[model samples]
Target: MRKVNEENERIKRRYLKYLKAAKRKDPSTVQKAADGILKFETSTNYASFKKFHIEQVIKFRDRLNEEISKTTGKPLSKSTIATILAANKGFIFWLADQAGYKQRVRHTDADYFNMDAKGQRVASAVRESPYPSLEMARHAFNYMPEVSEIDQRNKALFAFFMLTGARDGAVASLRLKHINLIDGCVYQDAREVKTKNSKTITTFFLPVDDEYLTCFIEWVTNLRTEKLFGPDDPLFPPAEINVIDGAFKVVGLKREIYKNANAIRQAIKEAFTRADLPAFTPHAFRKTLVKWADTHYPTRQAFKAFSQNIGHSSVITSVSAYCPISIEEQGELIKKKKKRNEDD
Candidate 1:
């Protein structure tokens, strides 16, 4: 029993390199493609790519349908199944164009890896997700206490997320120089900040001037004066973990930025939990900002800038991705239309 297929492994490495270097795919995307290919190979008992058959594709799909999700206590979602199939489908199609395996695997057979029409529709359908409202976000500020250095940092992290609508990755990686207190904006320099698609963006502070924004400003002031953090120092610096009493504890703040957004997410969870509210992931805050813009901004021109504030290149991109109309909102819109028509 072979644990690995050398030929398939070699091809997979080349494919992943192509995905990252040529296609400019992020590490996570490339890793997912590799995982999908591994799943297919494992199902066939690590069979050689040269001995591939179309029947194997059908068998894999059937097996996937039978698989139960550990999280939901039901079968895997249509979207998950579609993703798994799509990744394999792409790899199989690409594999067909390669030497040796080309003759054995027909490029047309890769179509068998595609999801059914029903599955496709289910995968494409958007489901409503919970997001924080402006009121709820403001309410959270009350829970944040600025007692210790770490406490102030956590409070500031929450305020910063709400103010900028920044992705957690960008938040974790921002430096002092990237922020402009006077201008009221964050410069997400892609060379340093971990922005999506490495896009450089400048996000202005949202029009919410309460304790939340004040807390963030105080922290910035403290960093500049009390802490004496230079322009290169992180805005929300990493926690200094110390082995006090032979046990690790977060004692203070480090001068360095976090390697990833996990700490920032933990802070959000803690803040929400303390506020007696359901935890919203950092990315969900962007949706909240978009929702805020939709109701508040009277003109399209204002809304366009609001969209740009969250790093959206186009207004349509912001509307299509973030501002999903709720069922209640949809009913209200329809009622308004009826009233207008009746009056006319």
Candidate 2:
């Protein structure tokens, strides 16, 4: 069987470039879309996408539901199906409008990619996630042993996340110069940092009383004054590897930030696991920050400032994305409001 359709691959590449340059979708998004198309093609044995049929779409939808995740060994999730279907739908819709295939495929055929109503609900449903509370985050930070460079880095990683509530990618790309202790903020300069939507924002230090922020400042200062690292040096450098006798050994750290956020995510997982907590993803910290702000800051201006700190243009976006009130919590809050109304 043909491994891939060259024509389809070429057109897909063009579409991906369009998504990146015109649509401004991130590389990760483009990659997921590309994977979805490739998976569909693979299932069809790389048959000409120009001759795609509604039957093929129907078959793929059913097949996707039956498929298991290679990593998790569990059935593929509704969210995963949603993304894959959306990708394929987009590709086919674009192809249907282009020359050569315009006469063959109808744009409406793309609608077949929609999952059933039940499936769509499952795909779109928001579940109450298990995120670490601020207190647990503080405990994790304090529990981290800082005897060696790696330990210090791990401690600093947890500390910095608590202090700034910055996304892992932005944190990974930060430089020593990006932070100003005097200003008590980290400026996520878009040109230098991998921020969401390439947003440039300043994160003021959180009022959380953990001194890990101080430790982070001390580490960067020592690296600059004592180690003679310049302003451009990575804030969180890579682990140092050395040849000890014959075996390769990790001694301390080398001056380099991670090329991406994967390492930081793994380190976070390890930290949470060691703290005897369920593994909460780094992104969950964003939700935690929002939850914290909601409890502490009641004024509209305060919420707006909180939204800006997280690089959101509006509070609505932040609320919609991160401030989902869990069903149980919603009921409890309603009961309290009712009780207060009765008293009034």
Candidate 3:
């Protein structure tokens, strides 16, 4: 089998660059789109896309349903298939307008990459799960030991997530100057913070447990006052490792910020594990806050403010994404209503 089509590779690279620089999609998203294109390339034996026929593409789409997923050892889930197909759909649509490919690739040909109407509806359906409760977050934060500097930092990290509902990527990139204990908020500057859509948001301390809030404040204060960290210093700096007595030990904090969210995600998971709770990602805290606010916000204005505080420009984004009532909860609600009617 021919390993590479130089022409296809060049075009794929161009599409990926366009996705990143022009469309502002992140590298991870663009990579997945690349993967989908690669899958198509592999199946077609690196056939030149300029010679793409509707019949070949339609057969390829049918074969997609037959392909087994390595992760699950089954056919790809509806959603996964939709995502893979959609990537090709997007690419082909773009190819139709590109200089060399315009003569062959048609807008109508790209339309074949789409899943059937019913399949798309099924793929887009959202599944609900139990998000961590505020009480559980408080317990986990309190349960974390403060014996070591690393412990203290990890504790503060959890508390900050609970208070601000900031994404893990943004948390990893936070600077000492971004947080204000007196104002009880943090400034998530997208230019620095790796926020979704590069949004700059000011998130206030959510009215949760006081001790958890204190944990967040004390850690920030310790860095500023005792460690003498400048405004440029990392809020939760990367762990400093040193060889002590011929053994590697996590001695203290480094001045460097994490290049990614992996460390923060691992720390929070370990924190939850220690507390004997389900491992929730740092992003889960945002959902916890959103679920809580859904009940408290009586007016549309209040909801909008809450949404904007969490960096969402639209209120429905919060409501649709976070306010999912589970099937079990729905049944319980119905049962309670029935009981109330009988009592009355």
TM-score of each candidate structure, all chains considered together: 0.95, 0.94, 0.92
lDDT of 1 by residue, 58-140 (tens): 99999999999889999988988888998899888888999888788888989999898988999899888888887787777
> How accurate locally, in lDDT, is each candidate?
0.88, 0.86, 0.88
RMSD of 1: 1.8
* Candidate 3 residue lDDT tens string, 40-114: 888788899998888877888888989998888999888988988989999999999999889999998888888
Candidate number with the higher TM-score (1 or 3): 1
Which residue pairs does candidate 1 place in steric collision?
none
RMSD of each: 1.8, 1.9, 2.3
Q: lDDT tens digits, residues 1-344, model 2?
A: 55767898888888899889999999899999999989898888888877788889888988999999999999999999999999988988888888888988998999999888999999998777778898887767777788887887777777788777899999999988898889889999999999988989999988766486787787777777877877788888888898999999898777788999998988888888888887777887888889898977789999899889888999998888888888888999999999999999
* lDDT pick, better of 2 and 3: 3
Residue 128 of model 1: what lDDT?
Answer: 89
Number of clashes recorded per candidate: 0, 0, 0
Better of 2 and 3 by TM-score: 2
Candidate 3's displacement at residue 332, Å, is 4.9
